[model samples]
Target: MLKRKIEIRLRPDGEIEAEVKGFKGKKCTDYIAFLEELLEAETIDSNYRAEYYEQEVLLKDENKVLESIEVIPESILKASNKK
Candidate 1:
């Protein structure tokens, strides 16, 4: 399971900004709606990070974020693509 997080900031002008992380694809949208209703404020603007476009690939009892990354060689990647 992804370790999801939401960082919400209350601006000086009382504008609310929330950055939702670790939720793949459009999963963050549900939280946005919840915030809007909870705060009784209409969202005037929104932005998505690159992660927002990625769909979650689930593996049972697996978390995708590795404790360490193992770099793959370009040659290996190219060879795999040919198959």
Candidate 2:
């Protein structure tokens, strides 16, 4: 997984400033593009580092491991309901 830190600072002039660190390549800029779009503001400035494009892909596999499980009865759910 890629690790990075994003800092947002609100200035006295009502301007918001953002800084991204530990990310490299176009990854940092590309990732933050959504923020600018969400806020409906143009990017005034940006700085990029080289580590942003690298990320580890985790392999997730599911295996059925069945074991005896006990479940609480439906009467408990009705008893806990306030309405």
Candidate 3:
């Protein structure tokens, strides 16, 4: 399992700043959209961190597909080449 955290800062000028962590690719934008609705806040500016360009990784249970050839890279290659 991966750890996810959101760091929020409230400035004296009534400004809200948030730093989202652990989410990769476009997932962060989804969170931002949620925040906009939840806080009724409009973003004045935006910036992308290094994590923005990374691929989103999904965790799956191995037992669910233990007998599936899709789990094996070599098997997938051989199956595709056969066609």
Best by TM-score: 3
Provide the clashing-pair count of each candidate structure.
0, 4, 0
Model 3 quality (TM-score): 0.64
Off by over 4 Å in 1: 58-83
The C-alpha stretches of model 2 lying farther than 4 A from their native spots are: 49-83
Q: What does the lDDT read for residue 43 in candidate 1?
A: 89
In the range 18-80, model 2's lDDT, one tens digit per residue, is 877755445466657876876667787665433444443324574332332233335755887
TM agreement with the true structure for every prediction:
0.62, 0.47, 0.64
**Native-referenced Cα lDDT, model 2:** 0.58
lDDT of each: 0.73, 0.58, 0.71
lDDT string for model 3 (33-64, tens) is: 88788778988888977666655444475433
Candidate 1 C-alpha lDDT tens digits along 18-63 = 8788776667778888888888898899997666655655455785
lDDT order of candidates, top first: 1, 3, 2
Candidate achieving higher lDDT, 1 or 3: 1
Record all residue pairs in model 1 with backbone atoms less than 3 Å apart, i.e. clashing. Answer: none
